[model samples]
Target: MPYKPQSEPGKTAYQPDVQITRLGEKIGDPVVPADFPHHILRFRNDRWDQSIGLHSLNDEEWLSHFGKFEPLADNLYPPLALRYHGHQFRQYNPEIGDGRGFLFAQMRDHEKRLMDLGTKGSGTTPWSRTGDGRLTLKGAVREILATEMLEALGVNTSKTFSVVETGEELSRGDEPSPTRSAVMTRLNHGHIRIGTFQRIAYEKNEALMLQLVEYCLEQYYGGVQTDDPAAELFAKVAQEVAKLAGAYMTAGFVHGVLNTDNINITGESFDYGPWRFTPYWEPGFTAAYFDHEGLYCFARQPEALHWNLAQLASALRLIADSEPLVAALEGFPKAYGTAFTQHFCWRLGVESRGFDEDRDLVVAAEKGLAEKTIQIDRFFFDWGRAENLAGLDENYAAFSEFSTLIADRERSRQPVSSYWQQSGPCSMHIEEVESIWDAIADDDNWKILSKKINDIRAMGIALRIG
Candidate 1:
């Protein structure tokens, strides 16, 4: 069932705590479009809204805040476009900031965790360079799919809160010319990136760097000890990001761009662009067409993320001793390996056989799928429960020993309900995505896209149960 908008409007739980102190020139007012119409495509993530205490908002109220970019009752006025430098494609670029997006509002969730309502395709900012700061409608759709799929796969991802079709035509070289435009809002944990730190480090501002480090720990890692706070923060972020890399691998996802700017300090996945989920277990699968060197390919994601974390460590050198930072960096490999094994087991719906055996199981499963050209999602869904396995083939022999163990454990267990048993696994390959967009571009039909989202959500529920 489609989510229903709140009917009985009540007081909003708006608590804006604008923490980024250096907003002297970083903040900017949103430039309203001349003839843009706000047509809400996906209004209701009631479950997600409840988390942030936003379930009381009606349609008009939602449109007011998210669609019109109006400030919340007590939130920050004139949305702030954050300032930061980044290494784009391994090249340092100091001009990058919120060119098309800005931090619209900040609020505490039910758990009192700070969350940011950020925008994309809102309007041009001071960092808009020489290009128009508009997002194509198709790009917005792709982001919705990416976040939903990742969340279902147990990845720490941002939720696509709302999407509004801004009546505008955008010309781009990547897709069909004169594509539709949109403005999207995402509910995320934090927007602080490794590049945010690099910006402070670039100016050789040790005092500012130390302040930022303390701010991040207080906001994101409150339980972390304050003594040696900078080193502790780095280690915590490194471990979280390493787990994120593991989740990506298990889900067969390629983030496409793992630049320092895109790597969030919260270790949550956001800013989806040119992302692809592999159909088969191909290590060299690259999502971005421009990645000629395959630097951020499926197999190289861990390495890329490690390198980005190292860049973060380098930036932190301005605030802390090199010894502690190095120690934290050294923990990533173990963290990633452990997370990979655990996530792989979760996907397969099997009990982990210690770290060593679980790692062996992951390797065997990957090799088996590659040799047999087994569809990645199909392999996971069909074998999620050990009892589902029937006749084994030569390619399946690699996983037979572990399968036997799982079968023994689940011999008398009740079978869990799953969508995969009734239908093929939900996937968002390039072709299917283009076809969905083609319908929108040619016929203005949205039923197919809506159904796809529903199906993907069902699959997510099944995965969670398994």
Candidate 2:
């Protein structure tokens, strides 16, 4: 019998929307999935899968689709090697595109929002500039940890959908050679990046650029209701990206590579690599070691994101007027300020007052944190559970204003989970991540990684993070 999913009453059946190819063949090249030596199903995310019902699929079926790259019932027949040029480390690189990953499938989420199932380390493609298209098992593990911790902290991110260890040993410079290898699939809003527009703009195809802008509006920003849809879409994207950036700050996350290609048009954080959570609010702290300039450090993320938005606006200028796009770019600071206040308050388990008052509270917290060498996550976790800065008598005076600011503010309706009290905090510091990966490399032990995911999910559920 064909695999059939019974839909819940009044809910739509799980359907695949093959919309990417509709953008025309010029957008991407059809490619085949690599024939891997092994198809070991490692991880599967069944959250928000009410309609797709992945939790019901057995191991063999999971491997068939995600591992063997077999098509879902009515999804894409052949995956697409998406084409886009990016500014790698602020240097324009037109020669690079989806070197390893490809768009595997497209579907709608429970909220009727369009979602994509994309891959990394699935195979080589036309865009594989000069490398074997493979993701290290360690890289896959790190991404799982990064996405899990980010999601638990309420940052909008790509879900690490599945990981399958290919029976292949690969050599690499960054880490140990002859290490294990794996392929990962992520469920995200879309694979469309700021670089996507850069590519179209580079070709000087104004008509195609206009078409691409409209297509993005239709697919992602359908709520942009202004008569000038192009500029409004830019503004919408600006606000979303701003929210994401501030969320990263409040979450103590440093997205090591904030390049054009790494930035999603939807403003959701994805393509995690060399990401880290700060032990404290050190503005100059960097994530990627190669980022010698500290270009995408903790404090510079807003700047980096704003710069990327400028690039997007520059590309949009090929189709839309420059004035409105510039105006949209100008909204970044205000958007980021508003977002930081809200996210900071939410993380501390307090309700936000007006923007200025809320921002003042955040400033106080950061100012105190700056003086002390404390982990930001601990402060957040402690505040969430106890609703007071009870410990750290030595640092009490400096940080007490944080308590004062929230004295008049009521707590949020969301209850802090007991997990916050039990588990210290779920942080993906490089040391801890390496420890987990070490266990896998040395002993092939996955229990730690599995428990960490559960613990992160438990924290998310405990906080009722929506």
Candidate 3:
């Protein structure tokens, strides 16, 4: 079926829910939104709104709900600040929670799966220690670019649903003297982080731990029929997290922060802080400037996420036996290997022959990338057209296996669209991101950003990925 943009969106089909509050005060705290002097709507994602049935909202209603923090119909009134503890940089930190954000609403997507609408830069809550609970406009812009590019690359990431500029000057030492402020709404699967489980276990609340596990099984992992729901849920989360790490690797994304709190149970990547796309297949690429030791570097992402999953296993032991959780942990490397092959094959627009051949294809592509240092996106784009392949020659045997493996497979999508026929692929390098922000900051020009998004969406459509 051909994909069609909705001529009319945001209909009354919105199916809202408030299941997060069912965990009661044990999971979160009710909090008020920050009052800002002004509210200027920056961006609203109409494509995603159609999924949640909020596409028809005019600018005023959009601002009223997202900017002013007005509650959605049948949604949480005073939004709840979720509580959790995380391992930051391999060290336990009980002080972390939803310090600057809170769950604003819940609804079902077009697939009828439960989804969360959360906020960033909302206001300070009990968890906001010392620092001001605010997000800079540049930060929001960076997130927009990151999520857009990641989504186009077939990564399971959060959508920056709405961004509204709030009139305020926030002081920060990182960027400039006083940066502009904004509030952003993130739409994703759920906010149940591995840290959520860790907090329950840290408190030695066995009943709450059981409750959390049961809720996860019922809502997130409903297909698991095992008697040991906790164990099965841990295994399912492990699989999903492995797939997420695989996506990051294939997308050449460095999350920069993969703490336990940042690893959601659904494996949906969110909270884009200091993220970077590798300029090429630079294995040691680090996104965050503060990562002195490169703790969460590009190649070490799987390790970082595995460590986080271990923390979740440590927490799940309150209800599940240690053996099953350990077994699940032991399977991370295998699961990651399978997912990386599948994702790599998909991105290359090639049909998979099997696990062995797919893995071989991936190894060949990596060798090809390493030998010539071909930029990741350009390699993918050039692969679609044999005429544009600059480095894949029989004279160089490093990419010969790659050429042979690719020759046996056929294109995944027939009659490939012209998006791949362009002179270049849509990419989100740090320089391009900074240039987009510079446009907005210098001339208040949003046209360049808008065009980039259109180009990315066109590429995504051409890629024909879910």
Candidate 4:
């Protein structure tokens, strides 16, 4: 059986009631499943999270979420309309929009946080460029797992709402010869990106730019007023980005590609591509196989973020001074440092005064383990067993079977070590290391460590722990 695409995207003849809203357009309609080629999971009548617990709806019943159930009903969409611009892969292409993605609507979660309902791989749009604008089944599977894994690791990221596999085929050069696509329903506060601002900046569209700044103030920076919106907006965006920079470094995850377009204007991790969790710290390590220059390498993320922030500042120059913008960038390292240190303490299960020598011992032990090629996840999982890890030397032998998938020579190393201590200063104190090890030796600590790893897997991402 061959693949066939929808005759017309966003237009459901069978369910004419399912509304359609274009990106940047005043939110028009809710996205109904049956209206597209998606397979429904139906609502679980007894569930805690309404949007998350939804089972695919029957074809006849799917129109309810889209405001199509009743005529002239107000569509359940996000209140804040977004405006942004950016270059893709360093190329100045200003024609991009939500493309195949859209904000289905916004809703309050069980925790009362305002979240938006977004659709990925919905279909082709005015901004589809020269591409077929379809998402593949692999993407749905990957996104589901990414959401689960990242959340378990305590990384701030978007949540997966639903994965609708449109039984449609689309062509893409990035796929395996011919391609099949899928769509993901994601929940997030904003789908805006740093590139969005860059786009307006490149075009020198100050009018559109200020419109975007006001929108940002109302949606994300509600605490800040918009009287002199440009300077304030730039400062706020810089701060958010700085905070996010720290979050990424602490999580041991590398986004691989940090292009302005992939960078969320809301300062959150948006599109996940060529991303990998660092099992060990190698400043030069990169998640993308194609990124030979190491521009967005593990160690360079902090710097990469600064560069992106500078671009944002340049965009906001229409109304702000460069000095304040640069000053705002200074806060990132400190903020990110504090956040990372706090998270590091929790992961290590240690409650000690900041800056102890025992931290050095932990660093040394990690280096020794890495020298033996210990798997990053496994080493940490079995850190308590440092005195008893029998197969630490051969833990990663299993990965050799998948060698064809990874190009790094060290990928063949067995029992990869943890990157946790690689960046520690040379003058580490012995007491700090012992304290960390003492904490690791406790069975209670091991339990938490084991649970974190399992939780990561259950959420959908497979972590390679030695």
Q: Residue 263 error for model 3, in Å?
A: 0.4
As a whole number from 0 to 100, the lDDT of residue 463 in candidate 3 is: 69
For residues 207-282, could you state the per-residue lDDT of candidate 1 as single tens digits?
Answer: 7777778878888998548688789899999988988999999999999999998999999999998999988888
Enumerate clash totals for all models, in the order shown: 0, 0, 2, 37
lDDT of 4 by residue, 235-261 (tens): 777766765675565456788778777
Q: In lDDT terms, which candidate is top?
A: 3
lDDT of each: 0.78, 0.83, 0.85, 0.52
Candidate 3 yields a Cα-based lDDT of 0.85
TM-score for all models, in order of appearance: 0.91, 0.95, 0.95, 0.67
Per-residue lDDT of candidate 3, residues 1-466 (tens digit): 1111112123347889878877778899999999878999998997788889888789999999999889998878789999999999888999989989999999887777788999999989999998788999999988988888888777888899999999899998878868889999999889999999999999999988887887887777765587898898999999989989999998999999988999989998999999999978888999999999999999999999999999999999888899999999999999998888888877777776767878888998898878655788877777755532355544345666687778768777653588866878888898998999999989999999999999988877776632
Error of 4 at 461 (Å): 16
Q: Indicate whether candidate 2 or candidate 3 has the larger lDDT.
A: 3
Tens digits of lDDT, candidate 2, 255-370: 99999999999999999888888888899999998999999999999999999999999988887899999988897999889887888887777777768888899899888889
Q: Which stretches of candidate 4 lie over 4 Å from their true place?
A: 1-48, 51-73, 76-83, 174-179, 203-208, 225-228, 352-372, 383-454, 457-466
- Candidate order by decreasing lDDT: 3, 2, 1, 4
TM-score of 1: 0.91
Q: Which has the higher lDDT value, candidate number 1 or candidate number 4?
A: 1
C-alpha root-mean-square deviation, each candidate: 4.6, 4.9, 3.2, 14.1
Ranking of all predicted structures according to TM-score, beginning with the best and ending with the worst = 3, 2, 1, 4
